[model samples]
Target chain A: MSTRSPTPVFLDTLRHVETPEGIELSLRVAGPVARVLAWSMDSLIRYGALWVLLMVLAMLGEGGMGLWLIALFLTEWFYPALFEVYAGGATPGKKALGLKVIHANGTPVDWPGALIRNLLRAVDFLPLLYGFGLVAMLCNRNFQRLGDLAAGTMVIYRDPAAAMPQLPPGRALPPPFPLNTAEQQLLIDFAERSTTLNPERQAELADLLARQTGLYGVAGVERLCAHARWLAGEPT
Target chain B: MPLETIAAELRRRNAWEATDLGMVMVRQWLGSIYAAWFTVALPLFMLLHLVCWGHWWLAPWLMWWLKPLLDRPPLYILSYALFGDPPDRRQFWRALPGLLLRRQAFAALTWRRLDVARSFTLPVTQLEGLAGKVRRQRLRDLSYPSRGAAIWLTVVGLHLEIALDFALIALVWMLTPDFIALEFFDLLDDSSQWGQLWLNVVGFCGLSLVEPFYVAAGFTLYLNRRAWLEAWDLELGFRKMAARLAPAGRVAAGLAMLALGLGLLMIPLENFAAEAPSRSNPPPPAIEESLMNPLCEQRRVREVELAQAGSSIKQALAETLKEPELHVCQVQERWRWRDDNSTESPPRSPPDPRPGQWFAATIELLLWLAVGLFIAVAGWWLWRRTPRAFTRARQRAAQSGPRLVQGRNEITIPPDAGLGDTAWRLWTEGQPREALRLLYQGSLAGLAAQHGLPVRSSATEDDCLRLAVAQLANPELLGFLRRLTRAWQAIAYAHRIPDEADARSLCLEWPRHFAAAGALPA
Candidate 1:
């Protein structure tokens, strides 16, 4: 006898859901505050390093007015360039903030993204200091600047831990999945590491349980979700 | 298993694997890279400028430290060739920015021809060379994903853009008769502190002064490139032709985008800056004393006036004696006739003019800052304000209410309201309960409109919420809506949301509560 039954409740509307747009599924992630905290710490470290370097050079140049002038130029220009090229990040500040610059399709940062974002720092620093940049970041999705939009890249917090493992072992199941080894590995890896998935992701996955279990366009996706959760050793 | 099950399983397993320290280390390393970039470049830049200007003392010290920071192998060879020995502490202090980075230092050394030969240390790659490498590395980049070619090109573009603007101004300024006589090269040679500072200031001023012209040209070039790439001109032309033929909305959208871009570009100029500078080396002052040149004579007259204004009788006389006219040594009688004992304290030392000069420079810098900010802000505003074709679901949720509760995954329909879209129509006719489930994802606009709160497509969630709360007597609905808005904003704009029970509760209760509240409102 199944105790779970559909009933009207205030909480019902708040269930994790996926709305089908054309191609890519938009995720509404909730509750992974650790990522945010980590990002902030990372950004601080990076910025701190940058600030240290500047001070050292300033000290080295020993109040040479010319060297100081060059420092100003370097602060605005080559600083970003080095990160863009070598580290594939913004200045240590942006990177430590858990933000990685990526192309629109979630690819590695290209030169355009790096240059645009960095060059746009001039704009961000407009009207005195970082006023425009802050405003732009506040307004845009992924906290992008004009350079980001133009370059088709985003500054996103990436979880290296988010990379999934090879297929989950020891579960007897149906076989017509049409997945290659890499794909299998990717999915399995994703499942094993699922605890790191923010609550919003968990909900989204729960909602999509039907499709992953090959129950999409079939009789019952919700039931499949409950079944899969049980199979995966989660309480259902 | 259902698709949802697979997704959930994958997500669960992924969470378990997120504990990899390696990934964390990579992140930290990437962060370090950012730090290194910020920290290393300024010092490196100072070193580069100093070295180029032949500040050999500091070169060795900078090289010793810089080699470790960089990835390049050739830098060591180059540093060795330039410095003969690595820099020591003594050389480091001697070569600091104050001494090394100045153009005056460069000029002074260049005049003497005693400094080490300068070479471009950062290699200059051809477009083909750069692009070929980028293409080859594309796959690798995708696998590891780092900042690659696009960033370099953009940097080059920035330099080119600024360079082109400067070049144009220089071209224009060079054509003037007065500028032709200006001894720019001599000024460059004078390596004194004041001389170098003055020259740099002048260069900065020049950059600012020619900003308007550069902006116009740069903007035109940018637009032309955009047009060529997007065929926007053709689109506009076609729209114009169509509009002329029938006079409809066919032309409005494209025109709007063009106007929008123009508006964004122009906003910086309009809202922020009046003037900014173009940088260039200043020509040295003329040596020739000939009064034939009007500009030179004007300067001479101005100098005489300033000398008179700045001096007392004795000082005036001293200055006059220095001039070719009025020889005080030869004509001692003229000097003797002057009241030498009348010591009135030199005209109450006119407030040192340095502060005023500094103030003007600050204002100029501020203007540049303003313009830059306006461009960035306006551009961002435009980018975000324009509507995308697809609506984010989170946005809808935010608009509905605060505190979305989990459980309800379907839309619901009110029995009285028959109007529905196609999907709703099908669900209502075939599966009334399913239709009700579908209706769970209520449009905030629909809810507002049904309740008669002057809601429109243009209204923001705050706007709707305010009106709804004010009009409705139920605090429960208001609270729910408020929580929903928070989630919606977080989800739509931030791409994240807070996980609270209220979100699920609001989603579940919205249909019945909204319907009942609308029926019995304040």
Candidate 2:
């Protein structure tokens, strides 16, 4: 129900799907731009490979031409499906772009889903150059094309797990007051991103909590950093 | 500049996601964006065509070249809209000249017109008010990480524009009647004035559709880059923390004063206690004995109170146990064989001994046997056709069986009766809610049965509407269904009775849309 709010508080493409095991998986659905780029990359690879095959086939006369046609058919049709099912839901291009196909419910793409989606690419390609697919993806909440929708699949960016940021050097100190979970996370985020923020702006931000910390300027910034370190489970 | 008032949720995001955020911005303010877009671009498009009337190709070429200029207004609107202060028409019109004539306008229109990341870099020049060397330096800074995505955004936008143009042509070709013999090659032949004009129009439509998304994507990408560089999300977080703690600080100050006052009051009490010498005086044994007697009596009284509390708790537990939720019972029905030697006679009369009766009985038995054979054949065919039919039937039975037992009755329209006539009759009978309910249920059932829409019984009205939009291709039918849904929602949720005219019109229109599909299976 929280997912279906008419006016959401925050606008992000992160879709949350709860599995049968009650674990929630957050998927950031890829948009049209990235998808188009990935498709283009795949197209280039397919064509390049075909061109090389054509040169080799030209040497072998008529039988090679027939063999080349069969190879082209296989490459055109089963190329994406094979990679999606066996290569962890990503074609070579998608793998290069760090994207993968998955079910709408966040499961990995299986053979049936892969085949259905790839087969329906013909419909999505109607009009010209996947125009219908582009329109469908743009209109969809999850950026699902017609093929993706029919096959109950979606393309998502395969985000690598982020390592914990090293806290700024400071003695670990407890927060002056009992900070809630969100506030503690904020403190940690501030500490992590402080390197990008200039000293003046950092001081300006720290000065906001001057009343709570009973410090201001650089000392206040350090106090917050210490709290962040403490919240990150640093001893003492 | 105040991050707190920023409409979009700000956080560290990859460049592509940032571009998607721009798409979100365009979607949210699409009306305003296009209103401003067409207001400026349509006239400009016409004017350019008029000026280049003799050279048919020149107009489209000029229009394509001037995309950077056309992109400014929408970006101007989006920038204000993002900070929660979308400009009114007059305000927007007033700002138009300044927005279009920014210091970088010349560079943007001429040398920078072909920039792959024009949208991404536009904000740096326009909103940030930087130009020339400063603008380049700023762009360099912003483009450090996001340049690749911005370039791709432009590339995709270019391809999308061409795709949409061809798609429109393809759509026209597909829709043309076969008897007309409109060749696809003829559609591509832009040698004639009409063909060229049509091509230009299609191209313009595609540009209009895609340009806003391009500009908005670029703008948000810029904003996202700025957010990362400046730690805007963290700044907002800090502001929120300050706002939250401000009141608490005042309360703490007030509490400190109260404590000070309480400490001063306690000082006098402590002094008074120290001055009391009778506090340390020893009493006699008779006084001690009196105290001991009272203590024993108090213990006996306490024991009685505890015993009374225990009995009252036991009574409450007994009372609580009588609640229906704690002790559920159900009456179940099952078929059982009747005893052959029952006291009550079978509820049947003795068979007639006439010869005509024997012939009638034979015909009836033959009819029953035929019916059973037909049922058996039909059942066998159904089983052969779909093995899962039995499982589905069992699931449906499991779902609906309990509601019948619980007496949760639903309205059932007879399959033979006309839906519109029945609904109208109900309305005239002053059961407006029932009439509307019948219409809503009938529409859903018709859609599910005829269209094979996956409209589950558990789906809400809104869900049904969404499913209808996805499944139904007939716009007129979709429109009718939308209106019907609105009317039904009004009655069901808001309890707002439809006007007599509206109710009558709905009933009359009902048969026009749904009659061909037949009534739902009761």
The worst-scoring run of ten residues by lDDT in candidate 1 chain B lies at B118-127
For model 2, residues B299-414, the per-residue Cα lDDT tens digits are: 22332333445588534533443355532222223333676433343445665679788899999999999999999999999887895986686567544421221112454664
Report DockQ per prediction, comma-separated: 0.01, 0.23
State the local distance difference test value for candidate 2. Answer: 0.80
Q: For residue B161, what is the lDDT in candidate 2?
A: 92
List native contact recovery per candidate, as a fraction of 1. 0.00, 0.45
Model 1 stretches with alpha carbons more than 4 Å out: A1-65, A89-91, A105-113, A159-171, A175-236, B1-522
Q: List clashing residue pairs in candidate 2.
A: none
> Interface RMSD (C-alpha) of each candidate?
27.7, 6.5
- State residue B366's C-alpha deviation in candidate 2, in Å: 18
Q: Write the per-residue lDDT of candidate 2 for residues A55-92, one digit (tens) a residue.
A: 99979999999999999999999999999999999999
Encode model 1's per-residue lDDT on B82-182: one tens digit a residue.
22232333443443343334423333334322211111111111111222355335323222111222222223223433443344334444555784665
